[model samples]
Target: MNDDEKTRDYNKAVAAFAKRYLPYKQPLLKTIENFSPELADVVIRHGLYEIWEEMTPLLSYRDKEIATLAALITDNTVMKEITAHTENCLIQGMSKKEVLEILTVLTLYIGVPKIINVMDAVKQAFENYDQHIKNKG
Candidate 1:
């Protein structure tokens, strides 16, 4: 493929992947549009599509998202983001028990104090997720 063709294909793949992952949350989309359209595009295109597509074969999406959540929980700087990712992991077909297992294992490396603090957030995420499923049903 020529340079132009390559760029076009990449853009197309990115947009498709973004739609799959982020879909259309109007408020969040609006915030991304208003504040950081470029960053948002990169996240949708490069971050989700390109990067994740490459890594997904090595580790499934659920595993990767769970690992990311554990890391974020350990760092304790991005609890909200972690919550979102945990939710995404669920949407992508990870079981709540599996997610909890990942967190349980993470406590070994991340220490008890951090896990203790973040466990509530994780549980709340699961509870909200269950409620959402019930409402959908």
Candidate 2:
């Protein structure tokens, strides 16, 4: 495929990735796409596909997400990432309870106050996942 065709393929992958993992952020992503089309490509490529290809042998995506969630909860990242990461954790192969357990484990180190906020994000992630399932049905 030519560069244009490769870009098109990557764009399709981005759309599907957003639809499946970011079900609630389509509008936000659309706005970003409207503003910076190149960003979505670079982010998707680096954030997910590249990581999976290069790092999965060292850490499975689900494990990476567990660590990602811990970092996000610790304020190592934008707290807003929790919801999406939580869902991604699930999609990558965590059960809901396992995802919740992540938060549970973090509660000791991060404290209840911070954990409460993380819980809210996780709740939203679960809700979004449910909505996606319902819509699929």
Candidate 3:
């Protein structure tokens, strides 16, 4: 494909992927698009569509969400992302018990403080998800 065609195809794929996976309808990408289209392009095209969707053969969406949640918990620096992935986990059919168990077990490896931080974020994420469903209804 020509460069223009490749770019168009990539943008289309990113849009499709982001529509499905992005949190809060992707306000993050939308906000950045105005001032930083390139960064937004990278986030959607490479980060979400390429890295995430292209891994479906090896990892299911639920597995990816679980892994992402675990990493976010360990990092404990981006509460918003942690919460977003927490909601994504639930949306992917991960039960509250399963999520809690995962976090609880992580306390063994990643320590209590980081796990505690994510625990709070998880709870809030659940609450927010519930509210979102209600509002949508």
In terms of TM-score, which candidate is strongest? 3
TM-score (all chains, Cα) for each model: 0.74, 0.71, 0.83
TM-score of 1: 0.74
lDDT of 1: 0.68
lDDT, candidate 1, 1-137, per-residue tens = 57575457456655544433333232564466468867765665466656776546798776777777877888887776766677777877989888888778887887888877877777767776677678878
Alpha-carbon RMSD to native, per candidate:
3.5, 3.4, 2.4
Task: Evaluate residue 88 in candidate 2 and report its C-alpha lDDT on the 0 to 100 scale.
Answer: 85
Best by lDDT: 3
When 1 and 3 are scored with lDDT, the better candidate is: 3
Give the residue spans of candidate 2 off by over 4 A: 1-22, 26-30, 76-79
Candidate 3 regions with alpha-carbon error over 4 angstroms: 1-23
Better of 1 and 2 by lDDT: 2
Ranking by TM-score: 3, 1, 2
CA RMSD (A), model 3? 2.4
Give the better candidate number (1 or 3) by TM-score. 3
Q: Write the per-residue lDDT of candidate 2 for residues 16-67, one digit (tens) a residue.
A: 5664475666675567667787886566544445554444668766677788
| lDDT of candidates 1 onward, in order | 0.68, 0.72, 0.78
